[model samples]
Target: MPVTQAPITPTYADSPPGPPVLELTGISKRFNGIHALNDVGLTIRAGEVMALIGENGAGKSTMVKTLTGIYQPDAGSILLDGKPVVLKSPQEAMQAGITAVHQETVMFDELSVAENIYVGRQPTRAGGRIDWRRIEQEAEALFARLEVALPVRARVKDLSVAQRHFVEIARALSQEARVVIMDEPTAALSQREIRELYRIIAQLKAAGTAVIFISHKFDEIFEVADRYTVLRDGRFVADGALSAITEAELVALMVGRAVNDAYPKAQAEIGGPLLEVDKLCHSTEFDQVSFTLRRGEILGFYGLVGAGRSEVMQAIFGMTPGVTGNVRLEGKPVAISTPSQAIAHGIAYVPEDRQHHGAHLTMPIQQNISLPILSKIGFFLRGHRAHETQIARHFAEQLELKASHLTQHVSELSGGNQQKVVLGKWLATDPKVIILDEPTKGIDIGSKAAVHRFISELVTRGLSVILVSSELPEVLGLADRVVVMQHGHVRRVFERGEATPEIVVAAASGIELESARQEENAA
Candidate 1:
């Protein structure tokens, strides 16, 4: 597929210009005395893809919320088709031809694909009865237009993550939205799925739809976005065409400084096997899965979403039942039937869904960190204030978590800081084997580096780690060895010396190993 062309200039021409599809002028918003957006201005043209680039807590989400009417700006003027308009709610925004697809897929798992596509706005017949047939037919048509295939009657829960993303795009298109905002739409998608999404974006552009693409991935922006806008500390910093700047320049603009290395890989020594899984089988999610994790070694599980990577971890962590396997710690087979059991065995798992699994939104950082290791300090029946303080202090300094005190609520912290608190909680447990799933998702570069360093340090201290990540570069940088999975089975394993981006990708895609390597080298 042909890549989309970048915009010719940063700002539109002063006097000679076409009418903007949407515009936000001098937009400002504040939450509890914190400025979320400061005089931010943006103008999106029809048939163009504008990338909203920023670090976590950089006001990208806030701006998107304002645009979609999720949050009304304290001061601003919105113009649609060169005319000022007031958008009071999300419904109003959609009626005005604006639609948003959030990072978290919002769909009824039990509902059929057709039902999900036309959820809130179902078709009606002459007698005002719901038109199921029409809904299914329309959904099929929408998917066809987007080049996505899905059974209209299939349950959403049965579809893969990438397929669900396609459904989201189809739903948006069905709404006849002229302006679409996709926030990290590719986060859960594989390379092939992302390429497909890019094709859909191209189709949208051809249909004169103004797309707002929000992502932290630099390569995707360069490949698909026409123009770029940077926000920092809730303020607009720069706006320009994608071709007018380089990746380094864009990073500098987004973070307000140069990032010498996005992936700062530190070297560590590998030791004998600390954790080993033999003949692990859990129903259909995994089968005969066997791997050995050495002390001070990072083992990466690289695969597409729904490739059984998370499922295997879930089973090993005892989050799921019906597993027949031999999990050994220091050459001793142990039974792990629950999370607590895994914890007792000196195993820690950082789940992929941080908001749902890692932190309690309403609880303070200290409480979240102290929850796991509460038994370690004694006073199980009584509160251990001193112990809590010591744990918080140790991690607050080590993780560079930004908070006035440990009493600060986890929800009050930024994405990066919340992630730090989660890591701090696990680190406090002193686990010999740590399973991290998507550790760097939605976090900034600085925080990612800090997390990477912590992982390296843990391994150096004789901790075995199972690293599951969607980012290929991260897997390549950190893993001493990589195991690729597809369709609920192990396809290939590559040692550190043999593992490259190409080899890993090929393995995951089910191509011949040697042929895949050659193809990668040729590229």
Candidate 2:
């Protein structure tokens, strides 16, 4: 049995009871003779932030799709404001006061912020012309209400990822949404941005809007959510006040097993440098960066958002042009100008933006796993079916991939499962060095353990790893050495023995040692 974890609990004072803003009962959905959801139930009152907690394949996405009307339930009842409503399409759901701000914000990138917010349902004048003035004013008001400053006239493509999420939220509010669903909204956001999102969620709750927040991060759930709804294996496991459950208890509910250790870095022999980068430069991104990855070692790169960490990795992997660097593999100089060349040189990179750059979501799981080695296996692929299956299944099982079958589309699996497929795909290439960027960004606690263990095992097998992450604990736990960066500059490098959370964060933020010590004293 697992025990309670460190203090990370949310407490909500009881309020006057009222009818639920939204109610779901006996919901069930099936696909290809497999149940995606079975007799699921949920109830959320107005002004409450209810966390939809689950493992990757625990029917959370299915519930979200069903609620958003992207998929109709085979059997269920949905009651909005105590009245039953049938949602046949997303528009119907939106018009019925239920809207969602997905992780990947979809909008007209070339259009203005205000325009994208009111793209489909712009207010019209008597002559049927778009009331542009009203749209801009309303958008400004929405940002003001959320306490964010964004230019209404700015193009959507020019906005940052966090800003794009705000635009989607503003669009939902413009529709006068009664129930707002935020699905992994902060997966890509910085710590500061995540705090801002929490404030916005509080604002919505105060305005009597029922919010359904879905995330794999436990700390976020306990900090922002008032209640909890856990799903496991396509069925509802438990629902209750977050204040009443411990993190260990919640983990048990979510995965039906104890996650004793969130970060279990297995011991591996540390060898001499396996890959060395000297004076790597990517103008306007990262300048004069150098690092060494020893065989059976994990080098962690930690920095804030836009700190040029990923950019440097892209340059190292040949995904970026104009990168001047001296790269040596096992003491042999090599020049990699493209991803193909990098792969051919026994290097693999799993990007941070998995949905777009990491995996081909449209392809089946097996096909995706076999993608990096298609040339090696021959393009004809007529008699290579068994060979592909053997390679794909080997890595999939190593990663603990969850799917009904290997033929299932990558898009159909949950976000964490999709990440696993991507990881498996790259590992199948049998690379000598792997770069995992934000490997566990949106993964569940249980799955995070699996990935960490896999990374450890990789090192034991004599493969080097470069891990780039925004999460401090993950870096401190898994890394042999920590490199901090700020404003495209390498700030400091700390060995595992000397790297502390405060010191590393201070370095990343460009804070001096004395100042950090003073701040700690102030605290």
What is each predicted model's overall lDDT from 0 to 1? 0.82, 0.84
Residue 504 lDDT in model 1? 61
**Across residues 188-208, which tens digit of lDDT does each residue of candidate 2 receive?**
788999898899999999999
Candidate 1 matches the true fold with a TM-score of 0.59
lDDT for 453 in candidate 1 is 78
The Cα error of candidate 2 at residue 509, in Å, is: 21
Per-residue lDDT of 482 in model 2: 91
RMSD of each: 8.4, 8.5
lDDT of 1 by residue, 383-426 (tens): 58888888888998998888988999999897888999998889
